[model samples]
Target chain A: MKKLINRQPGRVGQWALGLLPFVLLIIAYLIASDARLAANANDKLLPALNSFADAIQRMAFEPSKRSGDYLLWVDTLASLQRLAMGVGISALMALAVGIANGTIPYIRATLSPLVTGLSLVPPMAMLPVLFIIFGLGELAKVMLIIIGITPFLIRDLQQRALEIPREQIIKMQTLGANSWQIITRLVWPQLMPRLIGAVRLSLGPAWLFLIAAEAIAATEGLGYRIFLVRRYLAMDVILPYVVWITLLAFAIDFMLSRYSRWRYPWFHQQGH
Target chain B: MAIIEMKNLWKEYGDQVVLERLNARVEEGEFVTVVGASGCGKTTFLKLLLGTEQPSRGEMLLDGAPLPAEPDESRGIVFQRYSVLSHLTALQNVMLGGELQNSRWLGHCVGKTRKALQKEARAMLDSVGLGQAMDKYPHELSGGMQQRLALAQALIKKPRILLLDEPFGALDPGIRADMHQLVLSLWKSQKLTVFMITHDINEGFYLGTRLWVFDKPRLDPQAPGAYGARITYDLPVGNCEKNTLTRINRSVGNTSRAINDTL
Candidate 1:
C-alpha cells in the first residue's frame, strides 16, 4: 500500500485564499455604492466612501451636542460592557452547571431536560418578556444576551465534560481525589479550553441578542443608534457601525483562539 | 499475612455475572499478573481490587481491613490510555498525587510544602528517566515515554498496591520490553504489591510472582450467562526458573482440558 499525502497550499497561499473572498466582497460593495451614487447622487441605500468617512469622523471624532460625548465611543463602550458582563457570567455559570450535571447523575437528571428545553426556545422570543420584567433598562438588555446564550453554552460544556474519559476520573480517585477534588483538578482544568471555545461560539448569538434588545429600547448603544438613525435612512452611519461591530467581534474571537492556543497547548495539539 | 484477600467475590451486572465465587489471597510485595481471553473479566477483577467497583457479593479486604468504599491513595492505577492528565506537564503530573492528598480544594499546594512536593516530584521523574521531559506535556511524549510518565505519576503516591490495566498494551515490542524492566525495578525497589492484567500470556508469566488465568468453567450454549469466570489456574512463577514456559503451558492446557471435560 502506498502512503497518501495531503497536498495543500503553503501558509502564505492559504492566507491569500482566505482573504480573497473578503477582498472581492469589498470590491463588489464599492462598485455598487459608486454606481448608485453616480445615478441618483443622493442614494441612501449605498452611500459614497466620502459620506461614510464623514459619518465616521462626526460620530467617532466629534463630540455629540446633547451628551458632550463621542457617540461612537460611548455606544461601543456601552455595548461592550453589556456583552462582557453577559458572556462572562454565562461562561462561569455554564462551567459550574455543566460540571455538576456531567459528573453527578442526580443533577444531570434534574437539569439536563430543562437546559435542553431552554436551548430550544428562540432567545429572541423572550425579548418582550425581558422588557416587561426589567423595564427596558441596561439590565434588561444584558439579561437578554445572557438568557440567549447561556443554555446552549451550558449544554455544550456539559456534553464536553461528560466526554471526559472515565479512566481519568478513576485515576484521580486512585490518586486520592475526592468528588470535589476530582471536579476541580481533573474536570475543571480539562474543561477550560472547551469553555473558551464555547464562549467564542456563543459570541455571535450574544451580539445578536444584545442588538435586538437595544434596538427596541435604549437611549445609548450601537444598536440603539443604528435603529434611531434608520428613520432618516442614514446608511452611512449604519454601514460603518456594522463594520465596527464585525471588527470588534473578530478581535474577540482572535484573542480567545490565541488564549486557548497559549494556555492549552496539549489540547490544541490533540486537535491536529 | 495476606495483603490483599477476596473471599467468595462475585461481580454481576443485571443478570450477567462477570466474576463468580473468586477466593484468593495475595501476599505483600508480590508481583501478580492476571491473564485471560477477551471479555473474560480481567479488567473487572482489577477494578474490584482498586475499589473502583464493589463486588456484587462477598468481601474484599486490604491489609486485614475491609476495602474502602471509595478508592484512595492506598491504591494507584495506570490505565492503557489517559493515565495522566494532558494539561499538566510531567513534573506537575507527578506532583499531583501529593497535591491532591494535601490540598483541601482545587488541588493547590502552596508555600514551602509546594516547593518540597515539587522537589520530590522532580526526583520521581528523574527515577523514571524523565527528568528532562518534566516540562513537556503528555501529548509531546511518545507512547513509551507517556507510559513512563504515567508510572512516575502512580509511583509518586507510594501506594501500597499498584494496579496496572494493560499499561504497556499500546507500546511497541522494544518499548514494552523497556517498560517491563522499568516496572520490575520499580516494584522491587518500592516493595509494592502489584496487580496487573494483560492479554499477553508470556508477559503474565515473565513478570508475575504469581499468575491467574480467568475463564468460564462451564459453557452452556443456551444459557451462557448462567455461569461466570473464576480463577481457573493460580500458579507460582517466582521460583520456576527453567521450566516457566512449560509450567504455564501445562497448567493452561490442563485447565482448558478440564473445562472441556466438564462441558
Candidate 2:
C-alpha cells in the first residue's frame, strides 16, 4: 500500500522548499539592516522593513510633490509601455526575418552571418550612436532595447523554424499549399508558440536593456527612479523599486507562460 | 492509358549515379509497391514523382501531361516519420488541406465554413478509425494512431495519386497488419493510384498489384558511380494464383535480400 505520509514532502512542502531561499534572503536583509543601524544610525546601504514600507507607501499611494502624480505607478506605466513597444516590434521583426532566414536559402546565406555578427557586437556600445542619431528621446531608448535583443531573438526563432522537419514542408507542398500558403499557414502557426517561448526566454535581456537605457537617460521610469535615488544613497527607494521591477518581470513571464500553455496546448504537448 | 509514365529516367549527383535508364508505367487504380536495397533510389524515385526533385535526364508524365515543376494537389504523400504536425490536433491536421485549398494567406476558416470543415475533418477521422481521438495531439496518439492521422491528413485532400514511403516501417507487427488492411481498403474504395516503398519483402508482395525491384545492375570497384539502380524486376501480381504468388514472393524476397547484402 502507498503510504499517505511518506519520507518525501508533499506539494505544499515542495513549494515551501522552493520559496525557502527568498524567505532566508529577506531575513538576512532584515538582520543586516538592524546590525548596520546599530553600528551607524545613518547607514543608508541597507534600510529597515518599515522604511521600505514607508517608501513604497509614499511612491505608490502619494502623488509626487513636484509632478503631482503617483511616481511608482507612473514609472511602471512608462517602463511597461517602452518594454511592450520594444519587445512587440522585435517579436514581429524576428518572425519576419527568422522565417525568411530559415526558408529562403539565398536570404539565409546572406543574412545569417550578418545577423550573427550584429549579435556579437555589444548593444551598449551603440548607445552613443543611437542617441546621436535618434536624439535622447523615447525613440533612442526603445531602439536601444530593440537593438539589444532583436538579433538574439531572430537567431533563436530562425533555429527553431529551421528545426521543423523537411518532411512536413514537403508534405505541406503535396497538400496543395503554395509557397505563401505554406509560410503563412503551416510555418507561421507552428512557430508562434515557439516565438512566445523565445520571447519569454528573452525577457531577462530585454529588461536589462530597458533598465540600462532608462538609467542612462530618462525623465521617468522605474530604472530612472532607481538610478536617480542612487545619488542620495536612497536604498529605501531603490530596493523597493528593484523589487517592483522583479515582480513586474515575474508577472509578465507568468502571464506569457499561461497564455502559451492555454493557446498552444499542442506545442506544449510536443515537450517543448 | 498509363496514369504515370517514366521514360529513361536517370538521376545523378555529379559523378555518383543514383538511378539510371529507369523506365516504368503505372496505370490508374494500380497499387505499385517498390522494394529495393538501401541507397537504391526508391525515395529519389518517389521524390521525382512528387516533383520535389528533378531527374537528371528523363521524361516523367502524369496523364500524358508533363509533370509539374513542384508538388501539387494531384499527388499526396505520407513519409515514414514527421508526417503529422506536432502542433495540430488530428482533426486540425486533416482539415489543413481543405483549409489551404479554400482560403488565401493566413487562411483561418470561421463560422459556418469552419463548422463545415470541422464536420468534414471529423468524418475523415472517423473513416481512419480515430473519431474518438480527433481532439488528441500527435504526441498523445500511439505510433499506429499517428500514422492513421497522417493517412487522414493525406487522404483529406483526395489526391488522385497517393505515395507512401515505408508508412508501416515503424509500427508493431499486429498494428502493421491492421494498417496494411486499412490502407488497402482505402485504396480500393478511393481508386487511388498508390506508389509505396517498403523494406519488408512480405509486405511488398502482399499489398501491391505491381512490384518493382530497384538495384544496381553492376558493381565496379574502381568507379562505383558508373552504375546506378534500375528496375531489375517488374511483376504483375494482379492476376497471379496463390501458389505462383508464393513462389514469386520467395524468389523476389531472396533476390532483394541478396542485393541488400551486396549493397
Interface RMSD, per-candidate values to 1 decimal: 1.0, 1.4
**lDDT digits (tens) for residues A89-108 of candidate 1:** 89989999999998989999
Recovered fraction of real interface contacts per model: 0.89, 0.84
Against the native complex, each candidate's DockQ, computed on alpha carbons, is 0.77, 0.70
Best by TM-score: 1
Q: Which residue runs does candidate 1 get wrong by more than 4 Å?
A: A1-7, A10-12, B221-224, B238-263
> Top model by DockQ, which number?
1
* Per-residue lDDT of model 2, residues A120-180, tens digit only: 9999999999999999899998998899889988998899889889999988888878888
Q: Least lDDT summed over 10 consecutive residues: which range in candidate 2 chain A?
A: A1-10
Per-residue lDDT tens digits of candidate 1, residues B1-263?
89999999999999988889999999999998998766668988888887778999999999878898877889989999999998899998999989988896868899998999999999999999998999999999999999999999999889999999999999999989999999999999999999999988889878969988887776554555667889987888755565655665665555445445545
Write the residue-wise lDDT of candidate 2 on B1-263 in tens digits: 99999999899998989899988888999999998766778999999999988989989999988899788889999999899988788888999988887887766787888899999999889998999998888999999999999999999898999999999999999999999999999998899999999977668778879988776677564555568888877878665567855654565555456555655
Instruction: State each model's CA lDDT, in order.
Output: 0.89, 0.88
- Model 1 whole-model lDDT (C-alpha atoms): 0.89
Candidate 2 segments exceeding 4 Å error: A1-13, B111-116, B220-226, B238-263
- Every model's Cα RMSD, please? 3.5, 3.5
